[model samples]
Target chain A: MTANRPLILLTNDDGIHAEGIRYLTIAMEHVGEYWVVAPEAEQSAVGHSITLYDPIKAHEISKNGSFYGYGISGTPADSVKLAIHSLLPRVPDLVISGINNGANVGINVLYSGTVSAATEAAILGVPAMAVSLAQKKNPPFQWVVPHVERLALWLLKFGLPPGVALNVNIPAIPPEALRGYKLTRQRLAKMRESFEEREDPRGNRYYWLSGEVPIEESDDSLDATALNDGFVSITPLFYDLTAHSHLQDLATALKNLT
Target chain B: MTANRPLILLTNDDGIHAEGIRYLTIAMEHVGEYWVVAPEAEQSAVGHSITLYDPIKAHEISKNGSFYGYGISGTPADSVKLAIHSLLPRVPDLVISGINNGANVGINVLYSGTVSAATEAAILGVPAMAVSLAQKKNPPFQWVVPHVERLALWLLKFGLPPGVALNVNIPAIPPEALRGYKLTRQRLAKMRESFEEREDPRGNRYYWLSGEVPIEESDDSLDATALNDGFVSITPLFYDLTAHSHLQDLATALKNLT
Candidate 1:
């Protein structure tokens, strides 16, 4: 590896002013020269969306240039695409998305903009990692930062396989109580659907979408299972959605249709 | 299967007013009892996004009692969630998303709202299908609807496996010129990224994200590859994003960290 410092591109779904990004920036301060580009508003569940119809406005937010940061009026995926395609000084060595609020475990990853930003980078042939706290509220970043920093350094040193990005979720407990990191697969925990019907001021009916997350307590060492057990979960995620095992059966089924 | 009509919930990424959804509604009228709840505006490329922080507005747009449709002020995934949670009579027997204006093939499926809607239904243990045309401009749905109807009927007769959704991309060409369907995998197609910089009336600089899709030709029979060969592609997509092959390697890599 070159002696030169790596160029790290940082982004998140919780908006530019989120506490998670601030803590994440502080953690990466000593490791490499980094640039931060994130959405201006919270885009939490906006999974892999790119803003195509609207013009993107990117405003420089950093004053002293300690970390060149820009707040963009777009989705998390849009920020990553814009930063890598137009803003960065070359392709970044690494892309880190989030110190996100709440755990992106199991089926939640499919709806996570935090992981989507990292996935976008990985699809473009960059090494990427997405980190999340296992709570809805702010967790103790002091303990989480060191683990993230250590993982970042290791990734920079060893390098990740192409087309794969790590989805890391840290438990929201004290360092002493935490069980460290465990590499796991995505579990099947899903948010149960609940809608609240309400009448708007204009006398029109509207519905608010809300849900409760069901606990998945299978014996498998999946991300949700690990996080539920108070263990930090790290899952390697891929962009390939093809169900390879079912290809033959699907082919046979289509043959009958023809 | 019950002698009663199957309840089919319909939605799309192109909003409730798009021609694609209208055509799909007409086609579905013959097959089952239908209910439509879609976004109020186009929500293309929005993958699996659900509106969590904002209050959603769902308004009934259709007066015809035979066809019930609601226009939602949220993403496609949100519409699906709202419909299932509050709008539908019960859990829908099947969910059909899109006759989207353009094809959602290969890795593009990762960023597609059309496919994500189907993925949401599949995740909820319902049979689902996401259909799209290979055209960019105003597509001729007359030719495409027959194939869609046939496929939809076949799927209803022989249900899909749980947790799997079929992503069908029909060639834009006439039905006569089209070859039979091919059960394919997701291919990696290169979309060139370039920004168009322009000054607004206020002299503020902004960018429009623009890119060209490169011709993707792969030996493996993937969705995009099949489309390029003038064949209809039927890819069985799953919501599981875990890279199963890399789990062991990641486990070994993180063993010491714990």
Candidate 2:
């Protein structure tokens, strides 16, 4: 690790104008030479998606010394890809996504555009982290910025593994009131899905996709549990989705399918 | 599995108007009751993304008896979610996506909307399959329909595991001349990314993302290799994404970070 300032690529699932990304940008400004390339619209739940079908439009919003910001017409993953492949001076020393509006814990991480942005960077061999606040409604982010800055500094000092990125969810509490961080695992929480079937003014039928996340916490000290218990959680996430434990069983079961 | 006719949900990334989905619908018409709900426009490389920010519009496009279709204004994953949660009579006996325009083999699967639809269904505990052709241009799909029907029938008879899906890549050769199916694994060949920097007529600088997929055959029996060898390839894919092999090593390395 170098004592010189690290080049950090910052992004989020929320649009560039969101309070979450703004707070994150403020936090990261003092730590390193940073570039922000985020989506123009809120892209929550866009899991690992990249823009391929349409031409992406990137507008430069800021270009000062050691700092740059561009709002992209794509997803979080697209922002990271565009930054790395075109916009940046070089491959960034680290990629940090979010300071997201809500906690991306348990199976939620699978659906998180914030985490997916970080994962995209990690897949290309850059160190990365995805940070989120454990609240659905926007929380006051000023107090959490310092903690995020500190964590980012620590991660820069001690680099992450090549294909691993940290999924960090901080409790929405004051710094003094918050408990310390814990390395945790992902839990399986059921996202109860429901639909609101309605008719448009034209008398045609339509449905609104809506779901409620179960607030029930399990006994394990997983990411969700830590957030529910008022502690900041950091879960290491990877991109290789192979279930090695089931490989042998699958091999046996699929033997006859051939 | 029941001896009765299977209930199948058919979808694709090539929108409702593409010939690929039309051919796929014809193939599955005999296998079971078919419910087709696909994106209204091309959603090709939109990996595992779902629509949350916008109101989803689903319009019924087919009126054939026991054959229903919907045109959804969402990604491939969103189509599947809408089908399972609200549109279908019950959970589908099997979920099949594509007959997509190009091959979704190797690392290309990570960015494929076709495979992500199947992955979403698999994560929800449905038996799923994602089928694609190894051709960039649209080939005569009439010959491929019979082979797809056979594969679908086979899957309906022998169900897949809870969280796994078969990514089937078919050779574009005529069905009569093509070799038989081969059970294979995902190849490691990645699309080499190259940025084509361009200037708009209005004098704004932007980039058009372009990349070429190198056809280096990693193994003779891998998914990409099988398609290159004139055979259909069926690779079982899972969604866990945890690199369990490196978990212990990662834990040790992460412990040192503190």
Candidate 3:
């Protein structure tokens, strides 16, 4: 999975210490000159948010006495922005986020810090991609490493359009059991959430948000479905929020507004 | 602006106490039955994030000896989620977010907490709209009151397709100076950001993100342009991130992947 030596910026929502990023950093070394500017702590689910109200601080971090990169006190978007505009010696040729702990597919991608990191770069006119293991807990990330490298290399070679990124999810199966890649689209789906109401030691009642099950959307060509079927699902994603299909009709509808 | 008294869930990113929501809540009374479930403190730029790690807490609030609605210690998305799931007795007919402190036009909508609230409701199968004042400070939200009521009524009458939300931006002008409305698209624009390097009292160096100038994308039909021209800009936004245009091309490019 190793090739061109273009500079790459590596970051994740799982903080600088998560196993997903550490392995990803090691794998990226063969692909390019890589730098890691991730959050000092876990910043999961902090979508496309940036730190505007507070001062952002970052410093060099080392793993086992070897220089890894910088760890910042912010979200995934902040890390990427800070890296591109301030930290890195030069703007990287590509930005790759995660090897996230779980998949960012369907409507749930709206809350994904990993995907948002890549989305940030794409908005900044950089080619980017996000990799995730389909499993949520104790995902065997090693099974997805080579596949990640392969796709990342492909992104460098294939050069995505501006404001576009690939949201890639690999099925959490063993290497031998892994199927090939499948290009897919985000599913029209809903995540069923349940809150656990509890009383604290101080006698205050609180709610912990839990239980997200992807409910419907039975499209075989969709990202979630492709992942469920053991393929490396690559969904080409963009952030042009305009509902172009509804634009003209809406214009006509609102034409007579006072 | 008064019409059918539909049940509307009102929320904002600027906290419940902001003049924007206070005015919005009061204005909503003429249009429908409203319940304001919003963040206890300002939650600007907190995209679609929800509180998962911490237990969310919400309680009733009142203004001028009158009962308001619930305010929660969470993001705008969290407020909407908790409102829909646990706070409200039944699902609301429509959800309206903001009368935000600043314009959420162009690509900036991706990081807007106000828009995210409406987006969360839209994802949950409820019709939603987000209203933003083009001014960043001391915006005369009263100028927006009738227009907001108007468009909101239009939304109820001419319902949006599922997974879609209207991002509305009102020009920061007086009633007499206000131009009419325009149906616009989100501008493909970049916000030129500058970070200020500063020294703390303790002599530590940090960077504070400060400048954000919307640069380029000279499209007359864009939301930013319309607002700048003293018109109300209504943009139909849906968060299906799939890059459908590039899907087939990407599949062909990756067909021979090993």
The i-RMS of every model, in angstroms, reads 1.6, 2.6, 1.5
Docking level for model 2? acceptable
- lDDT for model 3: 0.86
Worst 10 residues of 2 chain B by lDDT: B241-250
DockQ of 2: 0.48
User: Which docking category, incorrect, acceptable, medium or high, applies to candidate 3?
Assistant: medium
User: What's the ranking of the predictions by TM-score, best on top?
Assistant: 3, 1, 2
Which prediction has more favorable TM-score, 2 or 3?
Answer: 3
Q: In model 3, which regions exceed 4 Å deviation?
A: A1-4, A201-203, B1-4, B201-203
Residue pairs in collision within model 3 = none
Please give, for residues A137-234, the per-residue lDDT of candidate 3 as tens digits.
99998887788778778777878877899898988888778678899998877788877788779887678888888786778899999898888899
Q: What are the models' TM-scores?
A: 0.96, 0.91, 0.96
Task: List ranges where model 1 is wrong by over 4 Å.
Answer: A63-67, B63-68, B201-203, B255-258
| RMSD, one per candidate, in order | 1.9, 2.8, 2.1
> Which candidate achieves the best DockQ against the true structure?
1
Scored by lDDT, the top model is 3
DockQ winner, 1 or 3: 1
Instruction: Report how far off residue A111 is in candidate 2 (Å).
Output: 2.6
Instruction: List the candidate numbers ranked by lDDT, top first.
Output: 3, 1, 2
lDDT of 1 by residue, B1-258 (tens): 347888888999999988888787778777888888999999998888988888999887865554459899999988888888888888888889988988899778988999999999988888899999988897987777887778878888888887899999988998789988888888865577778888899987788988657555776587888887888888998888888998888777765454
